[model samples]
Target: MLIAQVTDIHLGFDPDNPAEFNRKRLDQVLRHLNEIRPRPDMLLVTGDIVDRGDAESYRRLSVALGQVNFPVWPCLGNHDQRENFAKWFPEIPFVDGFCQYEVEAGPLRLLVLDTLDEGRHGGAFCEVRAAWLNARLAEQTDRPTVIVMHHPPVEVGIEWMNTDPAEPWVDVFRQCIKGKSQIISVICGHLHRAITCQWEGTTIAICPSTAPQVALDLTPIDAEAPDNRSMIIADPPAFALHWWNGSQLVTHFDNADEHVMLAKFDKGMQPLVRSLMKERPGAE
Candidate 1:
């Protein structure tokens, strides 16, 4: 099973400009996905589909998403408003008002969780969301499941983007999933960068934003000198592809923009390629 994840679209960044930067970046991502090798079984638009969570932004987003050739599942981010998002994505399986549900694809089960806490930048998993996740995790102990959400449960070192692990919501989340071996990984976005770390006994993979990536600054933010800090940067739009090759799941991060190849696969590399790909006499 191959799953593609693209996040932090922030489509309506410039509310008035029709040809906005975010829209262009998002289009580039979708086009790249449509033409990439090994088409994804489904796409997960992790979160931050729009900037302000306005109706028009969602309207534009919904239309753009229709062009994808595969299924696209999206959850909410801090920037998304439930009411506005529902207007465009009414079919989302929202349980008890949160966009959290379990989806079964060929060899993997995905639990899309809503970590959006309205009017806040950080993430939160309230009692309702936490309880639901615990029950779901308990029910499906056999499948190699991946818990999907917007915010990274563990601190990512970016002082501004990191979430307090001791926060009440995060605490509850850790308590429920700690030591649970069934979960293969926790995939998320919100830091706006491709980050990987170990959390609670499993791996956590964070996808980069499609719009603009957050600058990788590990220094503590000095409140008095906020202007001196590096925040957002216009890096290449990117996404993550998660591949489950029967036994293990491997993830790769790639940019939407076409790469500038330094060498051709013709003449010079043919023998090397053949040697690597050709079957050995003793192999399966």
Candidate 2:
């Protein structure tokens, strides 16, 4: 099974204009995913669907999402309003006032989580939500499960955007999934950059945003001082592809823009390709 993911679209960044930059970037990515060979089985929009949570923005978002042909599953982000989102995306059920649910994808069980603490910059998982997750985890201890959420728990050293390790919510989340061997990976977004780390004996894969990307500077920033620094950049829009090959869930990050071809499989490269294939363990 192949899963395509696009995050932090921020479609209403320029609500007045019909041709907004973020919207264009999202369209570029959706077009590529829609036309790519072996089309993705589903698309996961990992939060921040709009810059401001508004009914008009959601309406526009719904129109933009119509370009894709695959199933789209979205969670909530700090920038999202649950009331407005529920109105626009009625298909997604909100359980107990939380946008959380489970999706059966081929052989894998996807636990889509709600990490949005509206009006706050960070994530939140209350005891109620944690209890729900615990119950779900207990249901099938042997099934390969993937937790999909908006915020990644680890701090990535981008001082301004890092998730505080001492936060109460992080502790709750840690306790909920600790020692769960069935969880193979946790797919997340909201960092606006592609990052992976080993946490709680599983992999946390963060997909880059379709909107502008955060600058890759790790230097500490002083709030009082106004030092000119690159905070955000218009890097080419990005996405992630997760391939489930029975035992492992391999993830790949990519940009949605066109790239210059440096190599091709032609008569000159045919011999190299053949030789590489023959070196595989079970080459025919």
Candidate 3:
């Protein structure tokens, strides 16, 4: 299964302008996904769908998403308003007022969790959400599963954007799937940058944002000190492709901009490609 992901699409950043930058970035990524061979089975929009949780923005988002040819599953992010999201995306059902659900793909299962704690810039996985996840995990013990959410429980070293390891919700989330081998990976998007780490026995892959990316600065930051370091940059819009090769999920990241091809499967490169292919055990 090939799954495409785009996140942190802070659409409606400029409410007055019809042609917002975020929307264009999102469209570019979507168009690329559509044009790619072996089209993605689905697209996961991992939250921060809009700048402000407004009905108009959600409505506009609905229109923007129509460009995609694949199915889309969106989770709640810190900047999202559940009610407004429901109003526009009535197709995405909510369970007991939370945007949490389970999707059964051909050979894999997707458990979508809601971590949007309104009024706070961080994530939250309350008892109710934890219970929901635990129950779902209990239902299927053999199938490979992927947890999709907006806020990643693991800290990615971006001080201002990191998820504190000591957070209570992180503990609760950890306990729910600490030893569940069924979970192949946890896919997330929040930091506006691509990150991967092994957390609680599973891999967590953070997809890059379709909007501007967060600057990659690992320097320690002091809130009181005014260091004018770059926090965000207008890098090319990016997306992640998760390839499930029957046994494991492999993730690849790339920007929407077309790359200048340095090599192709032409006569000039045929021998190189053949030589590489012949390296395999069974290759003739």
Per-residue error for 131 in candidate 2, Å, reads 0.9
User: Candidate 2 lDDT, tens digit per residue, 1-284?
Assistant: 99999999998989999889998999999999999878999999999989899988999999989889989999988899999999999999788899999998999999999999999989999999999999999999999999999999999999989999999999999999999999999999999999999999999999999999999989998999978999999999999999999899999999988989999999999999999999999998
CA displacement after TM-score superposition, residue 5 of candidate 2 (Å): 0.4
- Pairs with backbone N, CA or C atoms under 3 Å apart (clashes), candidate 1: none
- Candidate 3, overall lDDT? 0.94
TM-score of 2: 0.99
lDDT (tens digit, per residue) of candidate 3 on 129-241: 99999999999999999999999999888898999999999999999999999999999999999899999999999999999999999889999997999999999999999
TM-score of 1: 0.96
Candidate 1 off by > 4 Å: 278-284
Using alpha carbons, what is the TM-score of model 3?
0.99
Model 1 per-residue lDDT tens digits across residues 85-185 = 99899989889999998888888999999999999998989999989999998897878999899988989888878888888988888987887888898
Instruction: List lDDT for all candidates, in order.
Output: 0.91, 0.94, 0.94
Give me the overall lDDT of model 1: 0.91
Quote each prediction's TM-score: 0.96, 0.99, 0.99
